[model samples]
Target: MIRGVRGAITIQENSEKEIIQATDRLLHKMIDENQIMPEYVASVFISVTDDITDAFPAKVLRSLEGWSYVPVMCMKEISVSNALEKCIRVMMHVNTAKSQQEINHVYLEDAVVLRPDLASK
Candidate 1:
C-alpha cells in the first residue's frame, strides 16, 4: 500500500542554516518515527511559508546519504494573516505495509500548534 507521512517544523530565523537544520530535524524525526527507509519513499512534497525564502527545504534532503535518488519538490505556502511563520511542511509518499492509521505524523517546535490532533503527546 502507498501511504503518506506528514511533518512540519518552525524555524527561529530565515537564514539558510536555520532552514536546513530545521528541515533536517523534521525529516529525520518523521522517518525515524515511522521506520521509513529511503527506498520506500516514492516522493516528497515540501512547502514553506513566505518568511522562509532563504533556502528550499527539498534541496537540503539531497545531502542525506540515501535521499539523492528520492524525488522532491518545494513550493511556497499561501500567506495568511494569522498563519504560522517560518514554517516548513512536508508530505512524503511511500510504499508501506502499514495502514494509514498506523502512520506517524510529526510536528515540531512552533509548528506543533498547526496540527494539535496529530502532535505527539
Candidate 2:
C-alpha cells in the first residue's frame, strides 16, 4: 500500500540557509516519526509561502544521504488574504503498510498553528 505523510514548518527568514535548514529538519522529523526510508518514498511535494523565495525546499531532500533519487517538486503556496508566512509544507508519498490512522503527520514551529490537532498527534 501507499501512504502520504504530511509535514509543515516555518522558517525565520527567506534566506537559502534558513529554508534548507528548516526543510531538512522537518523532513528528518517526518521520516523518524514514520520510520520511513528514502527507498520507500515514491515522491515528495513541497510548497512554500510566497514570502519564501530564496531557495527551493527540494534541494535539501535531494541532498540527503540516500535521497538523491527520490522525486521532489517545489511550488508556491496559494496566497490567502491572511494566511501564514514563511512556511513550507511537504507531502511525501511512500510505499508502506501503515494504515491512514497510524500515520503521524508533522507540524513544527510557527506552522504548528496551521494544524494544532495534528501537531500533537
Highest TM-score: give the candidate number: 2
Best by lDDT: 2
Q: Report the lDDT tens digits of candidate 1 across residue range 1-121.
A: 8899999999999999999999999998998999989999999999999888888888778888888999999999998999999899999999999988899999999998998988863
lDDT string for model 2 (1-121, tens) is: 9999999999888899999999999999999999999999999999999999999899999888999999999998999998999999999999999999899999999999998988998
TM-score of each: 0.95, 0.96
Runs in model 2 with CA error above 4 Å? none
lDDT of each: 0.91, 0.94
What is the model-wide C-alpha lDDT for candidate 2? 0.94
Give RMSD to native, each candidate. 1.0, 0.8
Model 1 regions more than 4 Å off: none
